[model samples]
Target chain A: MELFIDITLLTFLCITALAITVIRKLFCAVMLAGIFSLLSACLFVSMDAVDVAFTEAAVGTGIATVLMLAALNLSHSREKCPPYQPLLALLVVCTTGAVLVYGTMDLPAFGDATAPIHHHVAPRYIEQSQQEIGPPNFVTSILASYRGYDTLAETVVIFTAGLSVVALLGIRDRRGGQSITTDRSAMKGYLVLRVVTKLLLPFIFLFALYVQFHGDYGPGGGFQAGVIFASGVIIHSLTLGRDRTLKAFPQRFLTILATAGVLLYGGTGLAAMVRGGNFLDYSVLGATALAGQHLGIFLVELGVGVTVFASMTLMYYAFSYRKEA
Target chain B: MDSIPMNVSGHFNYWVAIFLMMTGFYVVISRGNLIKKLIGLNLFSTSVFILYISLGKIHGATAPIASETFHLYSNPLPHVLILTAIVVGVATTAVGLALTARIYEQYGTIEEDEIRIKDESL
Candidate 1:
């Protein structure tokens, strides 16, 4: 049954990806890309990588589509024809794919338990992670506890990307606050959408918080939560006005929040060091190792959530602001 | 060599991933629009994610969440890696789109060929 579902989803994914390539209208292509991501997320679920599936659905399908649409608003919706034929590109792609397929010939059969990947560190993580990290979700335990340093670096990468966007497209209004009113006219006639969005905003935020804290027990974590929270804000901005949304989460506040999140994660590591442990050694933060691990994971996850939420919102603001100008 | 048998059906997932990767690669190199290139890049990255996740799957295993009934769980390392990759993917996409938007603003066109022509003339 699982294999059936997997094959079906992969087929749909292939169709969506092919459609995106063939479609010239940028809007339709972006929408098809969203479907592609959604189908891939379904595939992830079937593969038993539920945490990855959740993040893929939220970030890949949700935020990416919105960002593409905002970018589309700023640029041309139709693709221009290429001056030259794509024969070279096709040749290169075909050669690379053939080589990769040849490489895969030596790989173990699908779902083979004795595959080499499962032989090394994965066994220890699967067997003793519950005792060492205390998270029922092994992904969360490895992500937040065992491999905390890498997660910290990933958060910093996110921060850097947000900074790059801000640098490229200045978030501040150079013309002062005069342009606020012009951008304030949101979906004026969609009364039903406005009402529905208004009703659902609270639950979206509640779910973000739930996902943030429940990573230890389920298939969600700071990354998914942060995207969800940011999406809620983005939806509000779409239905209501960007100006109103900005009034609540001012650009200055979001910048500070984004920086603060990285600082918070690093500070947790520093605190661990101060307690006579290695950097990011959460086992020393509290009276017991388990307690310290839990505390450390909580703090870092909170940090990740904050940075992602603020960064995504800030990116949206940057893109939409450019569209208006 | 005779003892080993070809198992094409077992490697179907990898074949699908390779197909998707090539499709995205074709789109990226062939398309003239900057936005289209970004979309193709996204497709490529997502396919790589699928490849990694497929590598982690274990037969008869449940998700990595510890449970009383399920003794076996799929490998969690790939999940951790891909989770971070997904967030980073979106971050890079935003950066790419921002650059595309700025390019549109400066050159008044997002078509790569047009932008090159404009650049050469200047």
Candidate 2:
């Protein structure tokens, strides 16, 4: 029974991919993207990472669809490109696919129990996180503590992305030039949705906090929490008008958030150095080694979350607002 | 929660996701229309989301919600991460929509070829 379902869903996913390539209509392609996300989430549910699945469903299907639609609204539905040069595209696709497949052949079987990934470093994380960090979710511990530097780098990347968006697109002070393409009529179902979003935003922020704090004990940490935090603001944008969303999370404040996040991260590393540990070592945060690791990780996670949220928000804002001018 | 089902077959989902992602990326690079590019972007993103979510399913797990009687709950971690990803997607969509509206205004025609020609003539 289970194998049948897997094969069927797998087939559907493949079909969607093939169909997306052939589909000429932009709108259909965007809608298919939503379908793709939904299917991916279902696949995740089949895999065992419920957390990743939930995010896929939300970000992939919901927000990405909205973004694509917005982008579509920027242009015509039909592609203006000359008809597909089948031979060229096919060659490119085939070469790329062939190379990736060849790479996969050398990889261990997905989720194989005896895979080197599970044997070497992953096992230490799986077993030790419970004992050292007191977290049931080993992935979180690894992300937040064991591989803290990587997470830090990822956070910095987001912050840098935010800065890039600001530099590239937000250079002009176009608030005065902002024009309205959407009438009240085009945004019909928003009155009630706005109220609902207003209600939910606080809870969303709260949930972000919980995820950030609880990351040491369970699933999630800075990156996930940061995304959720940004999402709360996004929901506000969707419900209320774009203008209102802008007012709530003004561009200046977003820049500050991004800067603060990077500073916080860098500051944490500096603090660790001062505490007599190597950069980001986290072993000298306080008294016991465990205590230092825990405290250091927490502070860094907060920094990471804040930075990611700001960056993601800034990117969205830059893209959305630029077409206005 | 452990209610989420896993399969005995191979990791087919990831492959599909990767394929869609690559195709979408190709479209984005090759297409001239702005909207078509957006569509391709969606394809690319959705494929990655698929890849991420496909990592979470347990052999026999329920949803991630905490329940008293549930012994085999799927790992809540992936779901949490996915939730964040979802929010990012929403934000990206909102921005994309806004940009589209602006593009329509700036260029009158949304075709990339026309926009580029207009730009070059300027």
Candidate 3:
């Protein structure tokens, strides 16, 4: 039954890819890409990776679609025909594909119990995470506690990416006569949009907080929460225009939040160091080892959430600000 | 009729993943539009996500949620890794789209070949 479902989903995925490639209209392509993401999220769910599916659904389908739509508004909606067929690119791709397929031949079958991956440190995480990290959700404990440094680096990567976007296209202080305000009247007549969005915004924010604080027990974490928070802000910007949104979340505040979040994560590690324990070693945090892990994970998760939310809002501001100008 | 390769039949999901991956690669390389290329890149990464998730599945197990009554749970490691990958993919996509917007501003077109043509004349 699972095999059947997997095959069906993969088939849909293939069709979506083909459609995306054949479609000349960028708008249609973007929508198709959203479908593609949704399908992949379903596949993730069926594979019992609900945490991954949740992230995919939020980031891939929600924020990415919005960002791409914003980008589409800035540029032409139609893709141009290529001057000539890319024979060399085709050859390269085919060779690379062949090599990758050949490599997968030696990999363990889809779900063999005795697979090397199942035997490795993965078993330790599954077996001991409950006792050690105090989270029934092994994925979260592994991500937040066992692999703290990797998650920290991932947060920093997001911070850096957001920073690069701002540097690249951010509307700096007008050197000449370039205007930064988008037409506020763009959403002027949509009474329904404004009302509905207003009703939903607070709930979205509340959910983001839930996802942030509930990471240890559920299928959510800082990364998912931050993206959800940003989506709410993005929706408001869409309905209420950029100026009002900026008033609510000013550039300076967001910059500070982004920086402080990363600092908080690193600071937790430093605090542990000052206590004469290894860096990011949460065992020395509270009176008991489990208590320390809980406190440390909570703090770092907060850090990750804050940085992601601020960075996302900043990136959206950067994109839309330039689009308007 | 029984001549089908064992690896091909047993690891059919892997083959499908490879096919999806190759299609994405072809689109990325063959397309001239920056946005299209980004879409293709997404497809490619998603196939990889499937590949990894499939690797961690057990025949009769449920999600990795812990329970005292059940002994079988799917491997949680891939889920952790892929969650991070999904976020990273979106971040890169946003950055790439931002760059495309800037390119449009400077060169007045988003086609790779056109950008090259414009650059060569300068």
Q: Tens digit of lDDT per residue, candidate 1, span A138-244?
A: 99999988899999999999999999998898876544655655655578789999999999999999999999999889989888999999999999999888887
Off by over 4 Å in 1: A173-183, B1-6
Q: Once superposed on the true structure, which residue ranges of model 3 sit more than 4 Å away at CA? A: A172-186, B1-9
Supply the DockQ value of model 3: 0.72
Ranking, lDDT, top scorer first: 1, 3, 2
Worst 10 residues of 3 chain A by lDDT: A172-181
| Least accurate 10 contiguous residues by lDDT in model 2 chain A | A178-187
TM-score of chain B of each: 0.94, 0.82, 0.91
Candidate DockQ values, in order, are 0.86, 0.28, 0.72
Most lDDT-accurate candidate: 1
| Candidate 2, residue B81: lDDT | 42
Write model 3 residue lDDT over A1-325, tens digit each, in one string.
9867977898898888888878989999999999999998898888889999999888975689988988988887899986667788779878987898888778887777888989988889988898998988888899888999999999999999889989888854232442335445248789898899999999999999999999888889989999999999999888887666776888889999999999999999999999878999998999999999999999999999999999888888887888556
Off by over 4 Å in 2: A1-5, A61-63, A95-110, A171-190, A323-325, B1-8, B11-18, B25-30, B34-122
TM-score of chain A of each: 0.96, 0.85, 0.94
For residues B19-120, write the lDDT of model 2, one tens digit per residue.
Answer: 776787787766666666666776677666655544544445555443356655443444444444444445444445455556677778776677778899
Please state the Cα-based DockQ of model 2 relative to the true two-chain complex.
0.28
